[model samples]
Target: MNHDTDAMFRTLKPAGLDTTVAEAHARRREQDLAAAWDATGSGRGVSAPAARRRMPRVLVAGLAAGAVAASAAFVIAATDGSGNSPGARPTASGTVRALDARAILLASADSAAKAPLTTGAYWYTRERETHFVAPMKLTEAQQKEVDRKLGTRLKGKTKADKSSPVTAWVSHTQESWSGRDRHARTIVGIDPKIKFASPADEAKWRTLSESQRARLQLDVPAEPHVNNYDFSHAKLLKTDEEKQVSALAKLPSDPAGLEKTLRKWYQDERALEMSLDGRTSENSFAAYVFGEAQDLLAGPLTPGAKAALYRVLAEQPGIRYLGTATDSMGRKGAVLALGTNGDDTGPIGKNFEIRLIVDPRSGRLLAQESGDRKAPSLTMTYEAMGWVNSLGARP
Candidate 1:
């Protein structure tokens, strides 16, 4: 859309500027977004003058909608204060002042988190994952669930002093019953790079953070309520540096039936794309895939890891199994063909594309790509979205 997709994505963050005002603004924004979305159909959109024939009505409408929702247009034109909202000011990154997810959550506990649930407490779902990293040790109640997720002690660890790279105990619970029908999902994490002066200096933050803090309550809003929250604020890291992959590597290298896991991720990413496609956006098939996608993405690769990778690549959407092959990187990776002509994928007919190249030696998405926007496809380089300093070459 004419509205920079990146900017639109930013507006969807856990907002707290105004509760009542935010909701009203949010509803109108959703409508504008939907209308803007309608204009992007491969076809079936409004006609444009010769000068703008290539652009869809959706793009134009989305720009207008975004301006209304943000309450002000973020013109690409020069600005003095970077891009942060007025009065909110901007950090070096153009976001609010520094403080990683870890510190922010701890400080926000007394303010944002409600009683019984406790402040600094949050429920997270990463494709069925219940584990999270924290900056501090876990509280007794929080440790129970963390232990449940870890499935065992940290190999000779004590309750008082456990050796976790990121030390913190967080909770994950399912609220089976609620007074209201709507569901509530909150995920709050920390990012050490945020750099707080010290506990005392940081302690005063809960008040300074009145605008950005998230409340641990049921039924906030998002067209699709993502139960996932990146408490780590690690989006800045490149794929090669993501903290979890190596941790997965530490697990038993000899994995059996790894196909199930691989296929799960393929299904998850594929289904998610389709659901996001807006055609079958409401189907269980898509939802089911998303529900399991994250579990499939992460791991302590068991004896079943490699096989799972092969199997999933064997069935990934827009992928054609080209049989076993090696990549230019010389990693013993498999090659998968992307695009509608894929024998296994049939025709998505959408303009999207995908490429999954893995290191067969270690079942990992060494490099991948996907998306309708060709310059920097969604494939594997999430570093796109222009968030990073560079957008690596696409295969």
Candidate 2:
């Protein structure tokens, strides 16, 4: 219905890939799109939760961590978009109801517009996630070398534990804080270990008749010594943070203007980033849109900016309305789907998707989840956001 919106969506999709493998790599890259926002401390003004110095590793490692399977789809549409029939509305805690995705998003836009404008000395986000990990093969010497380089010893305690690679379903609580001109800081805490001993154990596990790992209650080891940590050493220059913050603060509040401005912002960011490497790719559009959405949700935003962001999302192609659902934190909200619209027509075609969970009453973002449904899912929740006067302060 809206040509401008349609153009924006078209602009976001990368041109067709040369090979199925290329397509797979692109989809895999899309999963990490959100993490880039968390790691970028320059150009566009959003700061990763850690200093700029750690940019490369944070982007690469964080995004690669949770490659998992998606849960069953939670939202189902109840009505076809038609003027003759009003969509069904369900009462809270009652049966599922069908509603148009556009309507839900527009309603959210109105709600977002009414939210109070907020900012803080620091931009803060907190998240808790559960994901699976397959062990890496490292000899004793190699493990020691890794610890030497990282300044931390990470050996398994028992001889058997050290010899075997571990398969784990790890749960961790993480927090990030970004302030003007200072490095972003991140703190991470892990739950007690739920390890599968080693890859050998997992290999042997395959011989079992049932592959449902959930059926077996695994043992929880005490928190590993190297797991609980905090870091602020990454360097984020004030000038860079200020430049990005200034740019973000200046974004237009209307959808058309917002789209235009964001496109330019993303372009400039990519150019700045790629100028160092002397290579550039045009297929980054869709991924940039996804990353920008995550960035705005985590960064300082006025109510107007928030409203515009929601409207932008509502306009994107393949953004489906999945009705009410709860986040990993057990917060109930409506969910919207993006990137997951693709099917397995090509290699790794259906491997990427992002789900945004938002509070219907206030249009506040509750959480963002992306990655494969069958692998380790990466979920980041907006546990806290707002203007605070101090870096370590919580809003």
Best by TM-score: 2
Model 1: per-residue Cα lDDT over 154-178, one tens digit each = 5465532332122111212221110
**lDDT tens string, model 2, 34-104?**
22212211110100122223322222222233321232222222122222232344324343334555656
Question: Scored by CA lDDT, what does every candidate get?
Answer: 0.27, 0.49
- Alpha-carbon runs more than 4 Å astray in model 2: 1-98, 135-166, 190-247, 269-287, 340-349
lDDT of 2: 0.49
Evaluated at residue 379, the lDDT of candidate 2 is 48
Worst 10 residues of 2 by lDDT: 40-49
Worst 10 residues of 1 by lDDT: 43-52
Total clashes in model 2, counting residue pairs 3 or more apart in sequence or in different chains: 21
The model with the greatest lDDT is 2
Q: How many backbone clashes does candidate 1 have?
A: 28
